[model samples]
Target: MRLSERLRGKRILITGVTGFVGEALLHRILADLPDTTVVALVRPKGSLSGRSRMEQVLNKKIFESSRNAAGGTTELLEQRIDVVEGDLSTIPGLPTGMDIVIHCAGDVSFDPPIDEAFRTNVLGTQQLLEKIEASSPDTHYVHVSTAYVSGRRRGAIPEGPVDHVVDWRTEAKWGQAMRDRVEETSRSPGILSKLRKEAEREHRRAGPITAAQDAERRRNEWVQKKLVEAGGERARSLGWTDVYTFTKAMGERVVEEFAQRMSVTVARPSIIESALETPHPGWIEGFKMADPLILAYGRGELPEFPASPDAIMDVVPVDHVVNAILAAAAESPEKGKPAYYHMASGARNPFTYAKVYEYIREYFDENPFDMSERGAVRLATWRFPGGERVERILAMSERAHKIAEYVVTHAPRGERIRKIAREVDQLQRRLEFLRRYMDLYRPYVEAELLFTDDRLMELYHRLEEADKEDFPFDTGIVDWRHYMVEVHCPNVTESMRKYDVIRRRRGRSAPTVAKELPESGEILAAFDMDGTLLSSNVIETYLWLRMPELDRTERVREIGTMLRKVPGFIRAERRDRGAFLRSVYRRYAGADLEELENIVDSVLAKHVLERVSAAALRQVRAHRAAGHRTVLITGAIRPLTRPLEPLFDEIVAAELATDDRGRCTGYLSGPPLVGESRAAWLIRYAGQHGFDLTKSYAYADSHSDLPMLEAVGRPVAVSPDVHLWRRARKGRWPVEEWKTSSAANRLAIPFADELPAERTS
Candidate 1:
């Protein structure tokens, strides 16, 4: 029977229906063979319902052809397909009346944990075959495998069963053992913390902590590191590149053993990429085999890869693989007969690594990605360094990474400084992930194997004259240059751009500050926390009394640090109060952020809020009543002003730098809000929110606040310092003594007659 005719009315069951290959096959079958009923096996993903999963697959671009053909509606297409929510590894049997079973599901992670790969690939296949034999023994089973099942072999890899020496069952048992070992090593967070505390206590008994002690204190991290290393080592020792392919080889053996009693056609396709032609050209899903490297290089990120310039990469389009699978299923051999067909183009039409690199460079040169800051990225053919050299480069990069981490942790905090540090950290992370990906793929990209697809070609030639037009698997017809330049690269670049735009929108800030600002008639009141609204600075109080004295020496040292500031303060009284106050807070660099916040909460509840000036409180209440957006500007740390947060709409203050793990990193995130910095922040905030700065009000007592006071229309000097009193008089700003309510109604400082009439407080 002809391939297309054979598919009519056939009840076909396909696993991995949501995957790239499965998605393409569903479209092709629906569009070409309208009479067939496709029973798809879909596993429920996290939070996504089974129906939703099926809808998502059908919603992809590959299904557009089928949807358009079905009268611009998916109603008919949905009626023709049946979806079963089940797992082959644990589920009992296939849905009833299935004449063909196409198993396309398998773990594809390059470094998946050993047990998971075996469970999904080897054990799952065994269970599926047994269930199929019992339920539908005559079903034509099409087993989708990979061309890399040939392992570390060179020269020409033929279409046949893999000669793996290890028993499949033994390998599966080893997988279970590894999983058990990993589970045994895993410990709860509570247990880990308890052990860490004990380790710390033990280290305290010694003079100074050693590297071994530190490692012991971080037991969870050490165990995780060991497990990751063990997985790769275990796979290599078993003669497979990774746990993925190792388990896949074992799965092929499962099919081999089952074919002894039933018909099974194993189709091993080489690195399946986007569609070249069929439903649509340049159609692909998320970053596949070669895409990550290509994109990274285009962005001037990847410097080198582990592959020879002359190595032949066997790549086949998704449409060709889908065609071969359907054809094989229709013309499968008799029961108890098994066959192997390699789906590859390397043995026929080959593209060397050098040619791929040249094409990439040429394409990018013609049309480069528009990275505003980096300009247009130019491609340089990557160097194929030996394994040892790659390791050496990675070690050097690690050392540089360590130095960067230290610098970011120790640098002074400021908005720009913090931003640069975060960028550095993110770049390092990207480089590390790229390194792992390249290392895992090194064997395949650098392999010297040529895969022959004689069986696939023979089947293609046997198709009927009209069938050949619909199903073309001949690799010789593919134009490598045209596909790379006109189809594949453009698709990749467009996809990347779309993803970046979506990402930016998802992460974008809601509105600009200028847009949020009020009009000229609207009110905006800015207040200073330390010595303006509050009687004293909260941070100094914490340093003096709230700190725990570990010992007499520590207590004396803390006291001396405070005392040493007295001379500087005395000089700053005649010089710069901003410099003195900034110096005082620098001592808080090494304090634990969470612990400091807790201390602030306790101190606020105990005594800080009680010190708020009554007169200043009344004035703040009056401003709020007039519908003002109150802003609190302070040189102190953010946590110290938590008690007053409800009284203000916005707070601008100094920030503390924290590590990726959210621990204090002994540095400030940004500069303290003092002197002209406070004025600049207010101006920027007003511009962002569209506020009229000329109508805003500011209240402060220090001479360092002169710039901020001058920027606002209504500047008030509350209990003005000597220098500020003189400036308030010179600028004709109001001066008020915010004395206790019991003493008087409001006391105005005797400002020079040139000043604005002193306001009552």
Candidate 2:
């Protein structure tokens, strides 16, 4: 009988219809076995019901041909397929009288949390098998599993049950409890203290609120890392490669125990790639195992193939795997005994890592990836080093990149430093990705296992000649060079091209400002004073004020003193912005408060107003015209900021403490309006004045203003420094360059004479 003819009039239950392989299988059935009725078991996504989610799934491009073949998507869903609302986590009762069940769902992450792996792969499968035995005892079960269940063993693996002595029930229990244990250890005092220190170092300039959030984030990351490490250790101890395969093996044991009562067939496929012929050649949904490595090598990020040259790269096309699965489902084994099949290419027509590298190199050389201004990416000759040595090299490169990043980040701000910082950032991101890739894929690339697919081929030969022509599962006929270059390479590159365009669009599409400003008094517009609105910084303003009060020798001595302390100021600024401001203000010690006010009045016109950014002034005026409350929130001393008072409705500037004689005490009267304190103050002020923070706007340039910027709905980065620019880019916030006023524009400052008149009064 024809494969589709046997499947005709049968009722099938399929799981993981949303996943890549499951979706492809569903499409194949809908297109070929049009008479079969399918019940898809799906879990409700966030806001979508099961039926709605299935509708969305059918709308995917993979189902285009199937949809058209079945009259249309609506007709296919309404007349043929039924959506069952349930998940494997809690196995709802199976539909009655299922002729066949295709179990395709499991946690596919290579190193998921141990508990998740067990919950989805081991316990989930156990529940399904139990339910099947209870509700639909006569159903033929086809479980889709990976070929790598052979684990760390390196030899010719046969198509049969895995030999094991460990109790699967006990292993599942241990794996499920691993996360709780790791999380408890992560909460220990020593670990928390270490995480706290790291967080403070990274986010101190942003604020205490941000630092606390960072600490919590790091704690979660630590717990996750420990869980992954524990899972890997447990798997390796049990002779498995990862949590995925370990749990999968446990699932097979569950099936083995259930096989005494039910008919079962296990189909194991190795490294499924893009389609070769079925459903149109080269069709793919996402990048799979070898695609990342190939793309990385083509981009010149990976200079070496981290694998033995002679190791078999056992990859089979997805269409072949799908066909083999249908064939397995069609041939039901005798009750109380299960059949095993390996849908792989290694044992039939072996392809080595060396050949894969050569084919990919040839493809990329003919069709190179263009990198805009840098020209086309050139592929380098890759050395086939073993995984361990390559990992060690990557580790060394990461350490060196970290050192370079630290130096460049701390260096003085200039055009050259910015350029170097960008390069360092790119290298850091690339290194991080490469490290993660190596960690996840090292075992697979270095493995020496070759799966024998004799049983699978025998099943194919049993099919009638017409069935064989219509549904082919033989991997021996695939030309490795043609599949790698003509099919897989183009598919992966096209997917990557689409992703790159979407990523670039996301980075460039952040809205800079609202098209129409709402006229409301409850809306606030906050501006950082120095480096944001004006080109002058604290040091320059301090020099202009204090320099004229001293003799030539005293001026030289004061200048030398400030220059010597600049390095310390820079370090403090990076660690804590408030501390830096405090240290800088200490230079005002013993100077008369009245004298400083006088000096500011004299220098306020040429030294300060001339450096004001005309573009920033226009923004402030626009905010005022929109009936919004305008405020200047700065770390600069109050006396020096008095001249800019006319431009703001309120000024939250720092104040110096004075003694009975009215001389400066070189200390702030209260905490400086910087870092987290500024953010806290803004929140309190908003509460008191009934201002809506979600409608408020903030503009700043320094990293210290991150807290304030994040507090508002609209945050603009104005002439930002290296750290602030990077943060803005990460957050997709608008960045603007605010230039200093020209000589002609300086005379047009709003209420320029009002400050001197007020001081004289």
Candidate 3:
């Protein structure tokens, strides 16, 4: 009988209908097997119901032809498809009299947390089989699995059950228990201490609340990372490539136990790529197994191939895999043992990594991806150094990227620094992506397994000529060079490039300022002095004011003294802004206060005013126009802040204590206005002035001002440092880049060339 004839009018239940394979299978059935009724088991997502989610899937471009054949998407769903709401973990009650159950749902992450892998693949499959036995014992079951379940085995692997001694139930139990073990290890004194120290480095200046929260977040991340590492190690120890394949093999064992009760078949396909013929050639959803490496090579991010050049890369088109699945579902095994079929290409027509690289290079060299201002991306001949050596090289590159980022991030703020920082960030992100890619794919790429498809080929031979024409899955027919160069590469690049454009647009659309402002006296707009209102920092401002007081030789000596302590001062600044301010201010001890005040007044026009940001001035003027009180809260000395007193209603700045002789003592008259102290002062000031903090705004550029920003309803980050930028992005706060006058770049400061390059906090 024809394959479509056998499936016509049959009631089939499908899981993972939203996934790539399941959706393509559904579309194929709807287009070929007329009168068939399919029940799709889908889990509810966020606010969308199962039916709504299925509707969205039907709206995809891949289903266009199927939808048109059924008159429309609504008609297709109503007349042929039924959406059931449940997942394999819960195993909802099956629809009555199911003729077949095609189980397609499984976690596909290469190294997911062990618990998650077992829950979705091993335990979920067991529950599903039990449900099938209780609901419809006569139903023919077809379990979709991966050919890589062969694991570390080499040579030709035939269609059969995996050889193993471990019990499936015990393994599932152990895998699920891995999470608790990893969590306990994460909380050990040594691990917890390391995590806490890293968190403090990132968030100490933001205050105790932010630091504590960051520490907890780091602990959770550490636990998750440990769980993934444990899963990978356990899989490798048991001879499997990763947690995904290990759990999948366990799932097969579970299915075998239920084989005696009913007719069953297991279809294991090799690495599935874009569609070859059905739903139009080159149809694809997201990046598949090999797409990431291919794209990385094309973008010139990966300098070398990590796989053995002579190793066969068994790849089959998604449409071929889907067809084989349907063919297997049609020919169910007789009652006792389940039939196993390998839907792969290596046994019939092998394609090697060298051939893949040759084709990819040819295609890319002829048609290169334009990298905007950098022109076309240049491709290089890869030296196939294998996975381990490539990983070592990637590690070295990552370290170099980190060092470059550190230098760029610490450079003095300017247009040049901003450009370099951006480039460094991009390079760092690419390196991290490549590292993760290698971690997940190294096992598969380096493996020497060759999957044989004897059972699948026999099944194809059994089909009538008409059935063979209607459903073709013979792997020998695939043309590697034509498919790789003409179909798959074009499809991936076209789809992924559009996604890149959309992502860039979304990144640039983050609002920099609030659109609406009320005209009320109770509202407040608070600003931070250095780096927010002006381009200058305390070090630069101090040099501009104090350098002229000494001769060139004395000035050089003073700069050398301060430069030696810059690293320690930076560390102290990260730990406590108050302490850093006190230490840096001590350099002014024994200097005349009258002379310092006079120098500050004299430099107001040429040095300070020229450094003021025009964007910040406009914001203050807008606040004043709206009848909102404006305040400048800073750790800069009172004398230095005196020039900006007229711009704000109040100026709260540090004041140096003096001795009876009127010489500077270099001691703050009060606690430094930073971190938690800044927040507390703002709260008290608001209470006394009758201002509503919930309706007010605060702006700053340093992580030390995190507490003050958190105290207000609307907080803005102005040209913020890396720490502040991360917090602002997480909180969905407004971020503005305020530029200072161009003349500020030419301001003369002592030892500008000799001081270690560093960014202002």
Candidate 4:
């Protein structure tokens, strides 16, 4: 069949669209069957990262061969796919006219809880089947089950029905509720009986089918050993080590029974290696054995293993599995019996795990990642057991954590304890100096010559049928070597980053540069306290901020209005056109800079309160009406800003400003920065004071006001001028106007304080 005819406007839905294998499957399916409509059933978390990841793979060069073979761009193929939000456990309210449903949503873990594992894999499959049976009964069911589900049996595990048995181990060992679930879940007679029943069901569903049905089977040893008491002894007697194989055994049994009525074909794919085509090369994510095996070889960990140097490990590319699935669906036998194909690797080209490791070693050396070898090791081992001996390594980590915690708590001597503590800390330095190998990375490299891809190649062949004529899904058209060499490797190599974290004693960092200005005996705050605090501008803040275009009359009137509202209050408009900025030294632009500081000391001593803001608290308290924390930051000396202190959790302002006579100067000396200057000052303040600027907020008026706005993670512009207005529009910032004196606002606030008027300049 032509690729287009194979699809022929067929509507299909596939799950796990974001995964490495899932992505490849979509590309291959769409590449071969151009007329098929593909929909991705993305998990909920898929919404978080957005489409960047999906796009990254689709944009690779490996698929160019696919394009040449199938002859189409990724964008052209993508237009056919629509993303759908759905998980295996949850049924999506899909449209009624769906044709085929492919259940590829599965966790790749060999070890998963039997119940939850089944819930996602087997049960999820059942749930999807239920949907098809109910909504789209005519929909064909194509399932991709792993080849390893053959249980750990030696020799050629035939492509046939899996033998299942009663899992008494699950029932006898788990809790009452868990046990009840096992009984609830066991719809099949048994694994062994279930496989035989599949043939019988096939005869009834259609006619007698020749192909053997595929069933999954395994013996869960991990669960029995750990969760179950005395599991070690039982596992030794039963001969199973991992729950993956054990649960898989049960899953195979489930499939045998479920496939009875549904058009099901299980593709038992063995150890899926990198990529076969579609997305290209090794477009894989997370850590696979190959990655670590190669990592170790580069650094030199394992030189050899127990396996034969040339024994074929039966590895197939993800693309091959997807192709097999597509093919099985296309070639549904007249007999309704579920077909199972054991996708094996050595059937064509024999390669060993040892050789695979060698290639990885060569790749690692040839393709070094960012960071030195130490960083590479860190990246290589970021899991529970990591790449080392699990139990031993965990014990060592616990010891280190315990020792670090103990040292931190034991340093409380007296006046001399502080000194002695510092001295004792030197021991860490000594220990570090003794450890020369710490910087050197570990070694245990695996060569890549072992990885072979014949099975995948077979799947890549797009061919014609007696009636179905055309190579629609052929990967032979793709350029695999070019892909693995150039494109896929770069994408995987540069995605993650690492950083160092340090612990410092609390309250010991230096004061922010802004905070230090007042104490430096420079600058001053000429606060015209009243109207500035009372103005509707401050209350409106981040929202509804419009920059005011001011003539000299308006600026002077604003200053005058503020002065009259608060007697004996210094008046300062938001500096730089309501920028709310001023120099740390109150350095007058182009003025004799030294003179300002010299005179500032004599002018600042008058303030008694710490920090003050009439509008901020009212707004916060209004938010309290809706429920929120209220805070304020100011440039006035502490005593001056202190009156509004109770209204806020934090009030960062100039420290107590003093004069030459050690008396109140009333001129408001010291660096009393406001607005953008306030924002810059805030950054230094956070660094010194250890504040969370990302979580904190600041409110101000005017365009120059934006610096302070930018400083805080949350910036609110209150009655800003033209500049801020232009910015907020371009930046798509939220805007709202809050009138402090408005009756509605006053009623909304829990504490009502009348705002002071603007002082005259």
Model 1: what TM-score?
0.69
For model 4, what is the C-alpha lDDT against the true structure?
0.46
Best by TM-score: 2
Model 2, span 18-80: residue lDDT tens: 887888888888878888989999999899988888988898877787777767878779988
Candidate 3 structure lDDT: 0.85
Steric clashes per prediction: 15, 0, 0, 106
* CA shift of 189, model 3, Å: 2.2
Q: Which scores greater on lDDT, model 3 or model 4? A: 3
Please give the range of 10 consecutive residues that has the lowest summed lDDT in model 3.
752-761
TM-score of each: 0.69, 0.93, 0.87, 0.47
Instruction: For residues 502-590, write the lDDT of model 3, one tens digit per residue.
Output: 76576668766755568999998999999999887777666766675776788888789878888898778868888888988887888
Ranking by TM-score: 2, 3, 1, 4
User: Which of candidates 1 and 2 reaches a greater TM-score?
Assistant: 2
lDDT of 1 at 130: 86
